[model samples]
Target: MSNTQQLKDLTTQVRRDILRMVHKVNSGHPGGSLGCAEFFVSLYSDILDRKEGFDMDGIGEDLFFLSNGHISPVYYSVLARSGYFPVKELSTFRLINSRLQGHPTTHDNLPGIRIASGSLGQGMSVALGAAQTKKLNNDSHLIYSLHGDGELQEGQNWEAIMYAAGNKVDNIISTIDLNGQQIDGSTDTVLPMGSIKGKFEAFGWTVVEINEGNDIDAILKGMAEAKSKTGKGKPVCVLLKTVMGNGVDFMMHTHAWHGKAPNDEQLANGLVQNPETLGDY
Candidate 1:
């Protein structure tokens, strides 16, 4: 990975990309995207033992799945910035026929996107398949996945959870963004998912809690620990605590911006806060 400062700078730039992409379309999700900027940056920049280019097979490289596909802005920004595709292509986000859809899909043949997401709760099962395949192939590579905390209410995740533990799918690490805020409202108010860690532990999976999901250093440290636990006997889950709409002062601490775009004035404010790092698309 790049130095800590470089990773931070990329994160700031990714935030800018998310804001601009959503503002340009007057649509899309920015809250979750902004909240996960640091994790995306850290993962693509340094963490993954990724190969030179993109391919669906992933063969010997680490694979990542975005269960909460509404956050395509963040995912696209990171993939583009990481050279999976042209950074300039980020300008076409959400436009008709654009590879960068509001939700990720494979039909577009977009690099770095393995499966369609956004239905919520199905990502764990997909990651498990990949992990199990890796193990069968005797490949040491790991599979990583991210899910929205609110998305866990889907029930399908729990089934996958039980399946992973029971089948010993230990080569995968799934991180849940515990931002607490979701589209409808705060997760606590909308649907309380009591004791996510306990639930995972009870299912026989190893758990790693990242208290500062928005911090590069903290995420790197926590993820490193999670990586070490792979190949043991159970899957690993990361309870990542993040803040919705991080970096943008107004967007923070609320679910209002979950799928809303910033207007001209709000966009100006957001850009000013993130500044220009690595230049705009």
Candidate 2:
């Protein structure tokens, strides 16, 4: 199969893994996971450098951070599928003694994750720190981070943005899952972020908007454009417009499924939408 075909299959498999893992745990976030699967798949399968396995300092290679780590299901699935670990281990998600927890942490020394997250807004700071350190070391690889739209409410992210722009941390490409709905409800209803693109531009960051969050080809194009925007003395932010529950019909367009695991029936139905192109974990 072509690399593009492989990425499509990997993304479908990751979505299936997310559904099954979340269903088995009976408690985990799925909405955002489903929404970001394509972006993660495209990055891990096609864009990122994985010459070394889970290196903290991904020296001479690209790196990624999950700022919105509550979407651990998608991260874990992508990591496993990308050869960071055994895919079967996905079944241990959220179980006792499992390396996979409700949230991700580096304490477990998990093969793929480099930092602890899920406290919200802290990942951006962590990412900024990593980027700055890379600069100090004269590394050329770029750093990538993903954050939830709702998580922007945390003040720490803005501080990190300010720091990155002020210090000219230009090799970082961050993404916000602009899926509108959060666990509480619609993001606008919860706390409106008027003109997000304008806000980031005002903060001195280059911004790109991906109109189709679930389309892998579109995401790839947007990411390439986002990368080009980097290294011009500004951090790049991609406002990814995604559906809260992108693939599953019942779960879409609402915050009700944000943190709820599907029952067996729901899982069965959701799998039909994603299909098992690369086989479920």
Per-residue lDDT tens digits of candidate 2, residues 1-281?
Answer: 12777888887888899899989979999999988989999988876755757677788888899999899999999999888989999999999999998999887778999998989989999888888888888988899999999999999989998998998999999999999988789999999989889989999999999999888888989999999888999999999999988778998888998999999999999988887887666
Pull out the clashing pairs in model 2: none
Worst 10 residues of 1 by lDDT: 1-10
Cα displacement (angstroms), candidate 1, residue 73, comes to 0.2
**lDDT winner:** 1
What are the lDDT scores of the predictions, listed in order?
0.94, 0.89
* Model 1: per-residue Cα lDDT over 1-281, one tens digit each: 48999998899999999999999999999999999999999999988999988989999999999999999999999999999999999999999889998899998999999999988899999999988889888999999999999999999999999999999998999999999998789999999889989999999999999998999999999999999999899899999999999999999999999999999999999999998989999
Q: Model 2, stretches more than 4 Å misplaced?
A: none
What's the TM-score of each model vs. the native?
0.99, 0.97
What's model 2's TM-score? 0.97
Q: How does candidate 1 fare on TM-score?
A: 0.99
- Quality of model 2 by C-alpha lDDT: 0.89
